[model samples]
Target: MLLVYFLLWVIFNGSFTLEICVFGLVIAGVLLGFSCRFMDYSLAKERKIYRHIFGFCGYCVLLVKEIVKANFGAMHLILTQREEIEPVLVTFHSDLKTQVGKVLLANAITLTPGTITVTLEDSEYRVHCLDRDLAEGLNESEFARYIRKLEEEKQVRKG
Candidate 1:
């Protein structure tokens, strides 16, 4: 996580100056220290954590692709076939167990152009979609499945 913060800081700064690097290191260290209190420090040494980190990075890339696709689809619908759009509220049960996983999924859904996460109650998510087809894959999406798998792995590690 500190590495992630440092990389983001470096990227945002867009420079390799010694002063910026030192500042980023100090800030990231403080943030990581504060975050450690709320997180399971024991997991820091676990292989499962590394696996989840890599999986999450891949998930982020997948989310960006989905966002692009949704944007084009929504734009096309608005420009050429607005009449065919049947806005609907769809409710689905999410398989993700962790709060972080569930929140990530909800935010990802909301980030897509044609969908909004209306509510999240327990494992159930209510989403408003601009089109029915956009909501159809919510239940069977790879995002939920991957998060579920990650949660399962985490539970197994704990046990």
Candidate 2:
């Protein structure tokens, strides 16, 4: 994790001077210390990261599709049926077992135009939607299921 952080620092800084490298090392060390205390180290192992890399990429592609669909849905609703906008607050339990997966799910929901993740507690997410249909769709999202599968895949490999 420290190595990755250092590499990212180098990339962002666009420098390889001795002083910059030393500074990056210090910063990376501090960040890594905090990450070690708060993050699941098992999930950050190099082998595990490589193992799930392809699947994670695939998930991102699917997420883009969902985002586009949500945007068009919201546009259609706004243009054609403004009066049918029945704002709803929906809460549902997420099946994703990893912190990373849960956070990704929450961010994805918020990125969609018609929905926003209000709060996440444990495995439950509360979302505010522009309409009842959007809320219902969020409650039954395939993206959530895919994220849950990703979490389970990691656990299975770790075990």
Error of 1 at 142 (Å): 2.0
- Please estimate how well model 2 matches the true structure, expressed as its whole-model Cα lDDT: 0.85
Q: What does candidate 1's lDDT look like per residue over 14-77, in tens digits?
A: 9989999999999988877777776745335545567667778878888998899999998887
Tell me how candidate 1 scores on lDDT.
0.84
The lDDT for every candidate, in the order shown, is 0.84, 0.85
Clashing pairs in 2: none
TM-score of 2: 0.69
TM-score of each: 0.68, 0.69
Residue-pair clashes per candidate: 0, 0
Over 4 Å off, model 2:
1-44
